[model samples]
Target: MIYLAIGFPPAAKSCAYRMRETANNFVALGWDVTVLTIAEESWEREYGLDHTLSDAVDPRVRIVELPLAREDLATDIREFTEERALNPTRWSKQERERHLEHFPELVFGGWRSALEQGLLDIHREFPADLLLASCAPYVNLAAAWKLWEEHQVPYAIDFRDGWSVDVIGGGEAFTRDSEAGRWEEKVLAEAVAVWCVNDPIADFYRERYPRLAERVHVVRNGFDSDSVPAAHGAPNAEDGLTFGYLGSVNFKPEFLATVLDGWRAARERDPLLARSRFEIRGHIGAGASREANAHMALIRQAESDGVVFGGPVAKAEVAATYGRWDALVLMLVGGRFVTSGKVYEFMASGLPVVSAHEVDHDASAVLTGHPLWTGACGLDAAGLADSFVEAARMAVEATAEQRAEARAHANRFDRGLLMAPAARQLADTVRPALLTGSTQG
Candidate 1:
């Protein structure tokens, strides 16, 4: 099987975890998986690198690194043309327009030819029985389509978030008449299966393409067992409870500010919160603005309220990070559709959770049965402040049994459990076609 996982391990992106698990699970299911991703230097300019993440990948899986990188993230001035150097902003806009011409995808559509050629070369050397394309450089679909067009290789899409849905903006990203919408329609129409991270996204795709609804699957981004603490330590009330958020700070500045405002309000209202500390551990922005963006500025400004930015944590240190925190702050963006992978990890940590997102969010769906979770109440400062106070109280008064129950609620979402069966099912779906020498398309 050829897996087009552009954000595969070492990329340091949240998608990397899901990509890694997908490829590893395929290998475990007795398929020779080859992951196609951009070179390490490409990741360096984006999220830097996290070599620790590569440790979990099955040794049998082959990694094919393409010589592709995001041109916009170039930090070296020497690499830029004189025209680009003279007017970087205009150059970027022109580049985006150019990329859209080849395919509907922005930033990655230009990679269509390279990816198409790459797949053709791999197929010539070792014919592939199946192809699993993961998106976000939705350009991978172009390559998958290329292979299916030329060699009749069956393909599935790990569409973490469907391309048509504007998750952050809460609407259709593009109309069916638009180039992007047309591309998405074409790819998904022929795809053997399409997987989404949450049910809302899957439902969106189903509603959008009723004829292809049965092909859509909800695979979810589950928590890795190794990343969770073996046993959570008792909340240290003497030194004050520690609240932590461990994920990329990619939300809107206003959203983050609202969370900070709520934290401050909670601190003022509750004596326990006033004595407590809030630690944020994750990458803020990419390239020159990393750890130096408006988010960082906000976190810095909230220092007096006991907020501190601890930078990015290594995958190996995730368990230890969770172990140290008394409670977790699930600061997510979007409504209904956005169910972040952090929600699973936070719940699995067996710590009290304060949801700093919308009431209609899908994370609320996952956290509903969780005993220690302070329910979602939109991002209103007062409501979030109440949530914070409630979470602090839970952290102090909740029994270990309650924490155990909270952890148990997330057991169904263990990364391996969620992915292995999905991989096996895909393998089963393709095996008969391969055995009978029949083409899926």
Candidate 2:
């Protein structure tokens, strides 16, 4: 079996971890697997690849890198088109419209031809038994559909987040008549199975494609135990309290501003917070925005409040970086449908978490009973101020028993263990089909 996964992965973000685990799982299942994805230089422009994530990939798995690139993530000024650099916001708006002309998805629609051609080429050479398409770029589905239309290779979709369902706002993201809608319905129509990260997302797919209700499966994201440090406790902050956040700063500037305001408010209200430091580690706007974006400016403005905007940290340093933190700040977008991979790792961190997101978010569902969690509240300065205070208390007072129980809660979400059953089911479905095809060929 071969997988067509085109997530802008290993830029030290949520999707990369899942993609790595999925590829690893496929290889461990005693099947030769080939992974088709974009180039390393492309990743450098987007999230900046952490080769550490690829360390665990099975030696047997073949990774075929395409020359494809996401034009949006481009960073170097020398490579920039004069039009893109001068008026990036206007240029991006125009880019989206241009993409919508091809297909509804902006970053992905342009990728369709390249992905289809790549998959077809790979198939011609190796003659794959089964195909798996994971999306975010959604372009992978087009390639999967193209191959299946021509070759009838049974394929599955890892829809980590439902395309039609708006996880952030909790509603239909696009109308059925939309290009992406038509593409999703058509592509998923023949897919052997579809995987979603949470129940709500699965339910959305089932409701949207009632005929394919039986095919949708909920495969929650789980933590890799190796990503957490051996020692389980906050660093003593005699010098200063350290709060860390690891994820993209893709949310609205107002949203980012709210969190920064809250951090400032907390620092003003509490002596402990005043002496504390917040370190944000992740990619900001790619391409021209880079450090020039409003989010980076906001973090820079909060420097007086002890906020540090360290550019993206590599996956190899994830555990070590977390080791220095006194608490976790869960700044997320989206509502009930979003079950970001970071939340699971945060649960395993044994550190107090201050969630700055919608109160009804799916992350709140997972962290509900966590001993050190401060709980979710929409991004409001006042609310976040209270959460920061609560998180400080939790960190100051949390016991060994509490930490052990928190780790136990996350134990159910170990990456390999959670993915094992799903891998088994996929292998079972693909093996028979693969054997039948080979015998016929």
Candidate 3:
């Protein structure tokens, strides 16, 4: 199988975990999986690299790195041409227009030719029966379509979020007559299957293309068992509880301000919270603003309020980080369409969660029955302040049995358990003979 996984492993992007597990599952199904991603150095301008992430990938999987990159993310002033250096904003706008001529995606569209040719070269040498493409460099769909058009090789898409749907802003991203809409319609018309991370996204695709309704399936981004702590004890409020927010800080500056305001209010109202600490762990801004952005400034100013910024944790150390936190703060953007991968990991940690997102968010669906969740309080500072206090109460009073039950609620979201059935089903469609003798490890 040729797996078009641009952020496969070693890259610290949140999608790496899902991409790693998907490729590993194919390898386990007796398929010689080869992942195609960009060079390691390319990630330096984006999220940087986390070599620890590559440690979990199956040894049998072969990774092919292409010498492609996002030139827009280039930070070095020396790398900039005279025209770009003079007015970078205008230069970037013109570049984006040029990029759109090659493909619909702005940042990754220029990679189209390289990706298409790369797939052709790989196919001529080894001959893959199936092609599985993961999107967002949704340009991979173009390559997948290219291989299928020329060689008749079947393909599937791990379209975690549907292309036409604006998940963050909540509506259609483009009209059906738009270039991107045309591309999505054409590519998905021939796809063997389409997998979405949640039901809302899958349903959107189903409604958009009723003919492919049966092909669209919900394959939730479940938590990796290894990333969750084996156990967590009740919070020691006297010693001061620790609240953690672990994931990309991609939300808007205003959204973060509301969360910080709530945290400050909670600290003032609750004596335990005043003594406690809130640790923000994850990558902040990328490129020129990496680790230096408005988010960093807000966190820095909150130092007196017991907030510390611990930038980016390695995937291998995730379990240990969860072990140290008394509770979790699920700060996310978007409404019903968004269900972040971290929500599952946070739930699996068995820690009390204080939701700092929309009231009607998809995460609310997942955390519905979780015993330790304080529930969604919208993005209102006063509401979120109450949630923090409630989470503190739950964290301090939760018994061993309660924590165990909280973890139990998330067992259904174990990454392997969620991905294996989909992998086996897709593999069976193209290579049933291989699976007859195949046994999952």
Candidate 4:
């Protein structure tokens, strides 16, 4: 199997966990998986690479690193052209237009040719029976299509977030007549199976392409069992509780300010929170900004309210991080279309959760049955403050049994459990076609 997974292992992006699990699961199912991703150094300008993440990958699974890198994210002053150094925004805009000539994506379109040639070379050497493409570079679709056009290799897409649906903006990203939309339509039309992270996204694809509706499936990003704490320590009322928010700080600065305002309000009203601490852990910005972005400024400004930014945590230390925290603050963006992987990890931590996102979010749907969740409060300061106070109360008062039940609620969402079945099903579907020497499309 050829796994076109750009953010595979070592890349410290949030999507790496899902990609790693997918490739490992395929290897476990007795398939020789070759993951195609960029070199380790290529990730440095993006999120910076984490070798610890690579340690978890199955040794049997082969990885093929392409020599591709994102030019717009280049941080080295010496590497910059004079025009780019003088007016970065205009240069980036012109570069984006150039990239669109190669493919529809803005940041990753230039990688299309390298990816296509890479797949063709890999296939020439090994003769792959199947190709599984993961997106966000959505350029992987071009490569998968290239292989399918030339060699009859069946391909499936792990569309973590759907293409046409603007998850963040809450609308179609482009019209069907647009180049990007046309590319999405053409590539997805022939996909043997299309996996989406949530039902809303699957519905969008289904509604958009009714003839291919049955091919769409929902494969939620479940929490890794190893990432969840085995046991939760009793809340230390004497020293005050530790509230942690672990995940990418991808939300806007204004959104973060609202969460801080709520935290401050909660601290003022609740005596327990007065001495409590809020820790933010995860990658902040890419390239030159890194941790020196507006988000960092807002978090630093909230220091008086007991908020501290802890930077990024290693994958191996995730469980330990969860164990140390008394409760979780789930600060997310978007509405019903978004269901972040953090939601699963937070629920699995068995900690009381205070949601700082839209009331109509898909994460709200997942947290519906969770016992310790304070519920979504629509990103409003007063409402989120109430949620924080309630979560603090739950953290201090909830019994160990309640925490156990919370973990049990999330057990069904174990990464292996959620992903293995889908992986096996796709493998099974392709096995017969290979045995009979038949083409999928």
Candidate 5:
């Protein structure tokens, strides 16, 4: 089966790793997998590349690159229109409306013809038995639907975050009459299966389309074992304790400011934390903002507070960096349904975790039983300040047994174990149909 996945390996997005692992697992099960995705240059402009991630991809799987790009994520100043450069927010809003008019997809609507043609070409060379379409842009469903309409090949949809539900804002993303909602309904109506990352999202799909409830699967994102270092490794003994925050810096400046303020407050109260260092590693902005954004400025302000923004780290350095960290600060942006991929990795690191997200995020569901988790109350400066101090206390006082239990909680989410059954389910769903057709023949 050829996977119609657009966020395949080396895209640097969190979904890329999951896509790669899924593809590799399929290959291991003796299936030829072809990953359809945008070009590496497209990813570079959006989130940059980490070729080291490609090392884990089964060499047997083929990757087909689409000549598509997310203009919003573009970094090249030469390519930016003067109007867009002057007022990017307004320009992007207009661009999205224009896209909806044509194809009902915003970031990916324009890829309709490109994706259609790409699918056609792939089918012509090697007919696909099934098409597994993953989405965020939601345009992938269009391509997968096109294949189903044209070739009758069974397809599945992986909605990491539910399309119609606003996980962050907690409301309907769009009405049923709207273009995006209409498109979602139409495409999902024909899909054989749907996959959501968390239970809330899966429940959304079930409530939205009751008949398709059985098809929606919850496939949790798990940390890659190789991305975690041994507990025996020593941290920085001479300089100071390192508290790490790693993930894309896509949250609001006010939110980041609150976290920084909290860090400052914690430093003022706790002697150990006052002398410690905070290192944040991740992408900030692309295009014109680059390093000239308010987020960068805020991070710079915290430099005097022993806070250092270290930019993006390569995939190879993920484990080693975690090993050197004394504790972790999980700064996230969403409530209830939002369970980030980073939470699993952070939990697996066996370090004290301080949450900087909404009080009711889905991540809280995973970390609730964890002894070292400080817990998410809110992102208020003062509240977060208290939370940080509590986390520091936990870091210093947490027992070895507690750390071991934290790792044990994460052990249930090993990617291979979680995905193996899901993959087996996919195979099981497809096999009976193949056999029935054979018998009829």
Candidate 6:
């Protein structure tokens, strides 16, 4: 199988975990999986690298690194042309336009030819039976389609979030008649199956393309077992407690401000919170604005309120990081459609959870029956403050049995359990088709 996982291990993106698991699961299913991703330096221009993540990948799964990189993320002045150096903003705008012309994928469309060539070259040497394309650089769909057009190789898409769904902003990202929508429709039309991270996203795709409803599947982004702590140590809030957020800080600045404001209010109202700390560990931004964005500035401003930005944590250290925290702050964006992988990890940690997102969020769906969870009550400062206070109380008073129940709730979502079956199902469906194709041709 040729797995087009652009953000595979070492990229340090949240998507990398799902990608790695997908490829590894395919290998475990007795298929030789070749992961197509960009070079290590390309990741450096984005969230940087974490070699530790590569440790989890199955050794038998082959990886083919493409020479592609996001041109917009280039920081070196020497790499910039005279036109780009003179009018950087205008150059970027023109580049986007140029990229859109090739594949309607915006920043990644220009990479279409290189990706198509990469797949074709790999196929000529070691023929592939199936293709599993993961998106965000939805450009992988173009290559998947290219291989299908030329060689009739069946393909599936691990559309983590459906291409046209505006997961963060809440609505259609583009109309069906639009270039992006057309590309999405064309690719999905030929796809044997489409995997979405949640049911809401799968439903959206099913509803959008009614004929393909049966082909859509909800393959939730489950937690990695190794990333979960063996046991969540008792919360000792005698002196203080620590509330930690371990995910990308990609939310709006105002959203973060509201969280900080709520934190401050909770600290003032609850004596336990006043003595407690909030440690945020994750990537803030990419390229020039990384760690130096408005989010970082706001976090810095809240340093007086015991808020500290510890930056990105390695995959190996995730368990230790969660172990140190008394409770978790699930500050996520989007409603109903967005179920971040962190929510699963946070639940698996067996720590008290304070949700700082919309009441209608999908994470609420996952955390509904969780024992130590303080419900998702919108982003209102007072409500969130109340949640903070409640979470602190839960952290202190929750029994060992309650924490065990919380961890049990997330056991169904262990990465291997969730992915292995999905990988096998795809292999089962495609292997016969490949046999038929080879026989006929």
* Per-residue lDDT of model 4, residues 262-347, tens digit only: 99999999999999999999999998889989999898899989999888999999999998899999989999899999999999
lDDT of 2: 0.82
TM-score for predicted model 3 compared with the true structure: 0.97
Backbone clashes in each candidate structure, one number apiece?
0, 2, 0, 0, 1, 0
lDDT for 149 in candidate 4 is 94
Scored by lDDT, model 3 comes in at 0.91
Candidate 6 residue-wise lDDT, 1-441, digit = tens: 898998898999999999998888888778988888899889999999999999988999888998889889888989899999999999999999999889887798999999999999999988988888998788888898899899888889999988899998777999999988888899899898999999899989999999989889989998998889877656677879999999998889999999999999999999999999999999999998999889999998999999998989999999989988899999999999999999999999999999999999999999989999999889999999999999999998888899899999989989889988888888887767576666111
- For model 1, residues 224-304, the per-residue Cα lDDT tens digits are 998899766467677899999999998889999999999999999989999999999999998878887899889889999
What overall lDDT goes with each candidate model? Answer: 0.90, 0.82, 0.91, 0.91, 0.84, 0.91
What TM-score does model 6 achieve against the real structure? 0.98
**Can you give the lDDT of residue 437 in candidate 4?**
83
Per-residue C-alpha lDDT of model 5 across residues 311-381, encoded as one tens digit per residue: 88777889998887888999999898899999999999989898999998999998989878988878888
Higher-ranked by TM-score: 1 or 5 = 1
Residue pairs in candidate 5 whose N, alpha carbon or C atoms collide under 3 angstroms: 75-287
Off by over 4 Å in 1: none
Which pairs clash in model 6?
none
Better of 3 and 5 by TM-score: 3
Cα lDDT for residue 272, model 4? 95
**Tens digits of per-residue lDDT for model 2 on 1-441?**
778876534444567778778878878878778888888777666656787777776777788888887677666668778998899898888877776665667876877788889999999999887788888887778788888888887889998897889888889999888777888898888888899999999999999999999989999898888878664664454666888998788889999889889988988898888899899988888765777888888888888989998887777788888887878998888888987888998998888899998988899999989888887778789999999988877777788788888788888889888888998897787677566654211
Instruction: Give candidate 2 regions above 4 Å deviation.
Output: 8-13, 72-98, 233-237, 435-441
Model 5 regions lying over 4 Å from their true place: 72-94, 232-239, 438-441
lDDT (Cα, 0-100) at 228 in candidate 5: 81
